[model samples]
Target chain A: MTDSPIVLVKPVLPALDKLGAALHEVLRSGVLTNDGSRVHAFEALLSARLGIADLAVCGSGTTAIQLACGALGLSGEVIVPAAAFPAVAQGVRRGSCTPVAVDAERTFLTLDPDAVAAAITPRTEGIVAVQTFGCPADVDALAAIARSAGIPLIFDAATCWGITYRDRPLLAYGDVSTLSLHAMKLTHSVEGGAVMSTVHPIADKVRRLRNFGIGAEGALPAGTNARMSELHAAVGAVVLGEADAEIVRRIQVREWYMDALRHTEWLRPVPFRPGAWPNVAAMAVRLRPDAPVDAPTLCDELKRDGVHARAYFTGRYRPRPIGTAGPTPVADELGKRIVCLPFWGGLTESDVMRVVDAIDRIGGGRCHESHALSLEYPG
Target chain B: MTDSPIVLVKPVLPALDKLGAALHEVLRSGVLTNDGSRVHAFEALLSARLGIADLAVCGSGTTAIQLACGALGLSGEVIVPAAAFPAVAQGVRRGSCTPVAVDAERTFLTLDPDAVAAAITPRTEGIVAVQTFGCPADVDALAAIARSAGIPLIFDAATCWGITYRDRPLLAYGDVSTLSLHAMKLTHSVEGGAVMSTVHPIADKVRRLRNFGIGAEGALPAGTNARMSELHAAVGAVVLGEADAEIVRRIQVREWYMDALRHTEWLRPVPFRPGAWPNVAAMAVRLRPDAPVDAPTLCDELKRDGVHARAYFTGRYRPRPIGTAGPTPVADELGKRIVCLPFWGGLTESDVMRVVDAIDRIGGGRCHESHALSLEYPG
Candidate 1:
């Protein structure tokens, strides 16, 4: 008999249900597009909820990043983390800039401050720090480096929707932050994103850029329809409403995994700073040398045993441009060794036990904190 | 007491319902994004329905135009119709080309071939012909000019969905034809569009371009995500399925308006051509000198009578970025006289008569084929 295969991720249902209810109102009201009433309401709600003082909702996170770059007049070169999603590089390129990949920190699996500082060039207009796996990146250090270098910092916070760092919303530190509410994220507006900045003037420029760089207020500048539809806005409002409870539930689920696998010999979880509270969007673990089996072998074994573990972020590395070829050593190593375990909103303690037991059986590890080699894996 | 104002246009219903039913499936499946199965299915159906061999869907018509230009490596100056949607000019600019406008024919409100040929400079890379108000443009002559100039012909068929010209699908004649499926169009995918091309290689490039220039077969080139979500595709599939019937219904309503207003004075309906069958996406009538009131005054009168009539495609003369602004006589004249009346699937024949009766009462003379006179009444 086949075991129930665990899913990698599923959208939080409260948010999804909220979207449906919100859309019913939209269908009844015929205001479908063009910065309508629903869109305005959603923007206000998102900005207030996320503490984004200067946010303009746009079409997608990619578009958001592109608009931010366009507003900054960023061109020629941009420093991006080697471990980030392809969209980070793509966004830079969209602004007619070159993506200069910086190495990532081995311990944190996020952008390394030292590597980013070293990658700066006279041609560098900015740095794009991507918040990978729903975790708060080291934006504070990156921001300082960018400030000293006289360059802007753009946070691709596509994964850090409900996260905070040092008692502040995660998106607040960067010069500009872009968020994706794509279906895979913790919150989704079907397919939508926004560009948030503390600076009002840049926010205004981004608004114009998103809408085809229209002339200005009262005069229609030549702009395209970068405006999100009411349907999408309605969905976003619903997602925003139930995000707090959903995040709490997700954090609780993440805690179980952290506790159960704290002492496993062959695995290490990603590191986060003490003051940072992550969304735990995806539960990722790295295979260590002390394990009985390597990552690939363990992954095969898990699949055969009906567990659906995926090599995390492999697709992001496979198809980079010629000059931007191959993954950085940290990402290359982790890309092969790391796996995102069965994750979602409703997985039971039994499901967690099943995953833990399977990991222990295949890799031969103790389930106690004292047995772990990596300090990052919390008890 | 104020009367309820008439809407300028209404979406054809059975068609809108068809779209709603498709959305119902999306609600059930929750497959919201990427080149999902529904998007793919819609692409296939559109290819068959439009009689285009290859078609690829994108986020919007402007994006499709940009993608087509990007895929074709189009650069330098391009000739465009002066009196068209501002988006066409914006699209050309986004594609990194200078748009050179040719005066349109007063009769067809389309690109005048001789004018297009005269305006073409040695730097001109192509011609962008637009199908205005659901009318098939003079594509054959434009194609000849493009051929002689060794440049491709692009058609902005944003309003020509379900339209036929010369016994062939209007979209099939150009090198690259783009269609808009915004909420305002005859058929809507809730902010969507597609690009159809005759050349397979270019079509393949366009597909990659829409997807951020990444190919599954090889390395990732620079690209953007102009992807249409499953929600959009689901709605598109349902609309495309019912497009024919919707077109027939619209034509019947259009005929009713034509018969009712055929003898009204000072209001001139666009004359029909033998081979041109428009989608009737919008109905416009120009105010003649003999009317009871001019276009603006008549429009206000209609509004007071609870019929909402709007000036179609009316904007002040905009100059290109250069030495001096080119003249816009057609746009200037049309801006003052033309108004769009209520049309769409949901509007009834009685609604059509109400508008006609309002116009006839204001513009006292009969709208006849020969010797139409303007009407005047003392206040």
Candidate 2:
């Protein structure tokens, strides 16, 4: 165990000069929130960066999803991936709709198109598909299913800011897409998110929805205050300007983890599709069925080794089935076995090696006995 | 008309040196959001300043209200003043509750306790009382009603940050109180709010609800990401530190308006109750029923004179009664006649005199003929 701790993720700060300049602009303008100039500038910058025509910056990713649902007039039951973050389900409920969980594909851990199609009933109002762990999902297939069912498809691309599918931005896939700029993500606005849509009216509706639904003429609909302040947007503009480079650096970090653990028999990294360009937002590994230590056990071992590993998305993503609905076996198994390793831009190659070595030793059965002995000790 | 525009409200920027120091701390720490250190520190500072033990900073005032309702388990019908901001009704709807509108008292332009008591039915769940334009409401009376009815009282003290009721903080009255730190408020966080509760468990529930309901053990219930970012909190901390002094300055500005307009024949200001300390968040005046011009006409005239006066809270607050409800005549008339004049820290005595002189001329029938001529002109 090393003395210094390795955290699961660290926010990538923007260049000091750029951030200072942005703050200076905000101070000079004297406008802070309520769709101020800085928010407009950030929205313009993000729209250009993501190659989307229209984008609405919001207070958070969850609020972005809720606004998208409201803009699209979604009601009744909405289908979401059971293997995603709890925010996905929470956003669904916040939009005045019910969330019906569906199974995820075993390979990519994204919502399975077949399962979504099967889950759709006459009561289903919309579909929310996630790009799990920055891995690009089968958006085309899911979009086709949604279109056939005459429901809006919302791509929960919270981790897909720097991701691409077939050389185009992954944000181009869904009818309405949401991107999270939380600190934990590959790119951030300190704390913000954006809702993008190809349709101008829907994006306009989202803008109104973020600002109390007050339109140019008058109050259009009922809305809440989900606006990003100039202070946050200033930070966002600076961080987003450097996002592409950070994404490239994170890819190198992901490769370091993959190469270091390729020969290990106990852990398997989630495979990214060949043509998809992933941002590597999180470095997650699943314990093999025959592994010596389970996910929680390995997480505890890593914590003791001065590493902050997480047994990620366990109970939140795999809730007990409602009524006669059967459990999603693949998502449940993935939830039980998956752990997120410490991966951030601040980590050096040596740091990755230390984490890899610790996991390898723990899985080899040598460190487990030492851990048991430490647990038995009085100190 | 002057070349420079006198705006209705301007956000006060914190001291540059302090803001720079705070930004330096955030850059050094690389902690952006998720209730990080700055947010915790700001919450502590505000709780200490407000003399409240429990407070949770959130994304916006509307979200703060929604989180309060969710924390207090408010459901069914919630009573609210129809003269308040539209965000009040929006927040209730977001919390899965129906808002039953009630009229306000003509004297203070706040929720009438008698009206509220008469409006309560067997299905009533809670009461939302607002401090209209920073004038302290009858909190003790409202609290007594809520307690007798066994329902929670949420004080929407969005503009009452520095207000006190009988020398105590206005926040001390309700079961849960929410404050707005929006840019337009007397003191702002750029884009943020806070939820405070007297009950410890309710405050704890609010903390959980603000962060997707993910508690220490697991996800407790469905929640949304309504967290205040560190950047916003940095601004908040600085602004809050100077809030007391700022409130004093705003009160002086309010007095300037009052003294300048004291001799006016066609305008009347809302009076504050004795023994109550008001923050004077806004400088609003109502046109007398026998005045020469209405509120909208006067606002337009002021706008043409390079003063951005607002006919505030029109359609959203004076919404059509849902179902069989009758019109709230008092609130509707107030909404039609009330106008907010230019008020901010930067406004000088001369600026107040200019606005007062313009209003005096406009109401005296001299400026009305000129405006009518201008309207008839093609260019």
| Per-prediction interface RMSD in Å | 4.4, 3.3
Residue-level lDDT tens digits of model 2 in B1-379: 4579888988877777787777767777777788888888998998898888888888889988888888887768889887877788778777767788888888888898888888888888999889888777787788888989999989898988878878888776688889998878877888888899765456677778888877545554347888888778888888877777777788788889888877675687867777777646788788787677778778889888888998766764333333212457888788678888988877888888888877876765543443443222222
Candidate 2, pairs of clashing residues: none
**DockQ, each predicted model:** 0.28, 0.46
**Candidate 2's error at A329, in angstroms?**
2.4
> Lowest summed-lDDT stretch of 10 residues in model 1 chain B?
B316-325
Q: TM-scores of all models?
A: 0.81, 0.93
Which predicted model would earn the best TM-score? 2
Score residue B281 of candidate 1 by CA lDDT: 68
